[model samples]
Target chain A: MDTIIIDERIDVGAVFKKNIIKPRWFVWKGRKYAITEVTYTWEDTQGAARVMHFALSDGNTLFEVSLNLTSLEWRLEKSSVV
Target chain B: MTRTILLIDMNAFFASVEQAMNPALRGKPIIVCGRGRTVVTTASYEARVFGVKTGMNLYQAKQACPQVIAVEGDMSRYIDASHNIQRIAREFTDQVEMFSIDECFLDVSKTCRNEVDPQNIARAIKHTIREKLGVTCSIGIGPNKVVAKIASKMQKPDGLIEIREKDIPVLFALMAVQKLQGVGVGRHISEKLMSMGITTAGQLGNTPLEKLMHHFGIMGYRLKRIGEGKDDSPVDSSGGNELIKSVGHSHTFPRDTRDISIIRSYMMMLTEKVGLRLREYGLMGKTVYCTIRFGDFTSWGAQQGLKEHIRQNREIFFVAEQILARAFPLSKAVRLVGLSISDLKPRDTQQFLLKEMEKDTTLAEAVDDINKKYGVFTIKASSVILSEKFGIRPSCGMVSKQALKIKV
Candidate 1:
């Protein structure tokens, strides 16, 4: 699979349950999409910044979203079709 | 009272995990490597079918299969999957030993009853791992750890094989001598054996012990026993209880450099990583070792003993720099640098030092706490800031709990 790096900032709607953050909805490039599932989650460190990475789907396409905890900013890192 | 050991080996673990996570990547040839590194770390079976092998550079792999998908590896995800796989093995038997990130040995002799067969246990493990982790493993069941390891390699992707003691002779007769575990005879030794007209496991096993010993020393006897499929090593399950020998970190520069400032910054970065691990494990060492490899691939190593044990970054780097100074006035530019600490003892609670030393200790502990809570390099030494700016970090090696975890 080919990966296209898109470091664009986006809006995310998340929920805090039992000390865990779950993304429920997101708007990317002016298109709002409802998240059907969060397949996997992981953490990575770039220098001092901690990034929370999520692999989620919107019923048709899969996307990788990264949240920089230090700045509280979200970026769509990459995406693929189901 | 024969014991049964099962060895589970994951096939193309890094590439397999990437395929499992991405539905679009399944059933396609893939290679896993670091972002800028040329060496291939893992290749899926699809890529292997096209004659691509590990350690091949990207250019060579492309020549073998031009359409191969190359994915930059994520070590954290692989580590998480390894922990989960070990947990699944423990469900079958408490005697589970993690041999590496993608391999484990489980002692099932005690767990199996008259109604339960060892093969059934292996099947259960394979099924559960596939269902829960989305990975496949090949399992080998034998009378000992060595035979079990060999059995695991007899097939790939998803294979299950059992080698009984009574069948060792027949099975080994058809196998290559080098296929035996722990018997990595290099080209020279193999040529010598061939001159003696001995080429397979059966010929080696049938050779007289005195003649083999006269040529190869004690290792010859060990090889003879291995050729006969007899190994007494037990599957050790004392992971948490195992003693800590040494903690170290090493990095190879993308390009060889003669710049003293760049070399010193990299040294400090590695020392910080080593010190953090030592403190996290509640251990301190009195000896610090430094290794330097030159551009021509010639290497030098030296160690120095300290008056007191140390588990702080500055102290470790200070001792390491002292050793480096003795080896300096370089004959050639440096290619790689490594730092390790050994001769360890548990941390002492009593603090008997000057005010400045005590203050430094407190400051180091505070920085460690913050980095553990947030992420690595969050609070590093000012001298090592250049390392962060240049994105210098430790190269990946064998997987260990201490190497993977930032916090307990």
Candidate 2:
């Protein structure tokens, strides 16, 4: 359920819409992760959407779930986080 | 109708700036100078009450007021605050002349009418500087430039004095002769005036101009006119044709000493500072001058014109040191040593002999570029390090071979 809770907060649709998914690597409340999938809610609610993903650079770690924009406030983005 | 001119001088600019930033320094005796072994650039009015003053050696100032808090002078902050005050002055009139970093002359003739009070304008300037810049200034209003300058100094910080043309004799009666401009030129003339029982401006003004001239030549005629308030000098804001006339620096030691090594070391440091600035500004000078102030407050200056314009640190040091070598007593302790380079020319087109020296010229230009990009002290001569002194180290000191390209 906690993993599901984490999955729900990171909305893929909003991340893609705001261009925050690419080039971003960060930890949330001490959980290290990376964005892998972004999806849209609908055309009418243009900004509000959902996301599906895993944690890795160059497709190394496996994660799968659906997330909504209404939950998590934001995510971190950096030029080169290594 | 007599036009009123106001001269406003800020009290202890740098120290006051610090005090204004920090609430605790208010009413405290403070001297703003360089941290170790430097001249007191500005002394608070509290410190001045005890005979401490700007240009007095730090040790001498400490002798005058032992408890004075000495702060290193910050010219940048003072310049910022000065620009603010200058902006405020422009709100009143465009005819404002900056006399010094902390002093200004405002020609309010157009703004002030016959019945309109000049005191109101003085109070406005004072209040504006205090409220806006957190500093105070003394204002003096008089009929002419000399009288206005003297009147402004008559009062202390935040005080104002006004002298009208009709009241010149009355004002002259109460003031000493030294208070008049140009009266302290010679000792014998003062004694002669004293012998005649004409010891004040009023008495001197009463003395016929012809008799005064007979005693002191043309200067006597000038003195009589000054005594009677006949100064016609204008407040020239442009400082016309004085294009950076002389660039010089003087530093006072913590203690006075006659050691040639120490004196030469300080002069060398000063010479390098001036030389670097000359090169940075693309200027070279033919005339180099040196000044020495003794412990007794007596001073002497000597200058010589070089055969060619030079900007090298060694060249400036050599000329200044040579002058001092011939002029210095070698016995009397020196409190201050100053160096100035004048009669400047653009370094790019300077004529020179010797092929290697000309090559060195190109090298100097390249080094100047490096220093400008990476910051000063990025590149310096080995002689500068060999003759290292206890002053500013000349830069941020972060060395990198990679050139920092600054966009013009």
Candidate 3:
């Protein structure tokens, strides 16, 4: 599978319950993807900012998304077709 | 009571994590490595079937498995997964020793006394791990760490084997001497044992202690007992999990360079990172060591003693910089730079008597607070600007350097 890099900012729909941030759906390129499952999550450093990466599956596709906790921004890092 | 140690070794940890995250890669060949690194850090079982292996250069891995997909390793992902696995293992026994990021030894001796069967425990642990984490482990159960480690290798991917006390003689009779990994029977030691006509574990155990002692000195006595599949080493519950003997950081350059300025810049950056961690751990050190590995891979290093223990980044950098310069006048291009501090102790609680020193410490603490709230390196020293321009980022993988050297 070819991973197309998409280091682009996007709006995300998330639920904040009991201090847990869970993404329910995200709109990218005007297409809303309903996340079927959150497969994995991990964090890494980006300069001075802490980056939280989420591997989310949309039924048939896997998308890599990141949140910049410092700037409170969301990004679509890359995506692969399953 | 005989102890029962279970060695739970994950199967192709990094690659399995990758497969679990991306269903597309499931049941397919994959190799995990850094983006720029040419060597493969891990190869999935699918790739292993085609002769792909860890430490193989990318080209060689490609040759072995043309369809092998290369995935960049994310240290955070693997570390988090390892922690989760440890949590799961603790559900069965509290005496869990993390042998490595992908392996651990569980001392279920007490659990067994409660009439719990070791095999059932292993099976339950394996099932929970697969169901919850989507990864598998091979578990070896035995009377000691040595036999348990060897037993774990009998089956792979998802395997469990128990080596009972009664089975020792027959099982070890034909077993090669080198298979006893916990005893440190490397090529050097095993070759000597083979030369002495001790080809199998049984013969090694049968060898007279005096003769073995004369050949191997004090190590011979321990080797003979290990040959009989015996080891008394406990599965330490804490296992020095919180111990930070020394704080250090190292970076391998993209290309070897003889530029002194670039070398010092990197040293300063690494030193700052080390100091940040030392402060985080509330540690102070009185010794600094600098190491440089030339392009040829030969290494040179020297340690300097500090007049007083300190956690300030600049103070450690000056010592580390001087150590690096002492090797200088540049005999060769340097490929790697490493900085470490030893003689560590907790920072004193007393306030600094001098106003200047007090101000500096307070300022550093404030910077740390901001960085902790915002991000790392948010208030980095100006000396690291060159490194930043060179795209030297604070990486997650730096912790793995300290993690790998831990003894099982």
B395 Cα displacement, candidate 2 (Å)? 13
lDDT of 3 by residue, B316-346 (tens): 8888877887998989998788999989999
Which candidate leads the pack in lDDT?
3
On the 0 to 100 scale, the lDDT of residue B150 in model 3 is 89
Output the lDDT of residue B98, model 1: 79
lDDT value, residue B63 of candidate 3: 97
**Best candidate, TM-score-wise?**
3
Give me the iRMSD of candidate 2, please: 25.2
After superposition on all C-alphas, the RMSD of every candidate to the true structure, in Å, is 4.1, 16.4, 3.7
Q: Write the residue-wise lDDT of candidate 1 on B327-376 in tens digits.
A: 77887898688999999999988885688878988998899889887777
Residue pairs whose backbone atoms clash in candidate 2: A12-A50, A12-A51, A13-A50
In candidate 1, chain A reaches a TM of 0.91
**Chain B TM-scores of the candidates:** 0.88, 0.78, 0.88
Task: List the candidates ranked by TM-score, beginning with the highest.
Answer: 3, 1, 2
Off by over 4 Å in 3: A1-8, A14-22, A42-52, A59-61, A67-73, A80-82, B208-218, B239-243, B254-259, B293-298, B327-335, B393-408
Any runs in candidate 1 off by more than 4 Å, and if so which?
Answer: A1-24, A34-53, A57-62, A66-82, B181-197, B207-221, B252-258, B292-302, B305-308, B325-336, B392-395, B401-408
Query: Least accurate stretch of 10 residues (summed lDDT) in model 3 chain B?
Result: B399-408
TM per model? 0.84, 0.67, 0.87
Candidate 2 residue-wise lDDT, A1-82, digit = tens: 0112132233222234464443234454566555442211111111223322222232332233323334443433111111
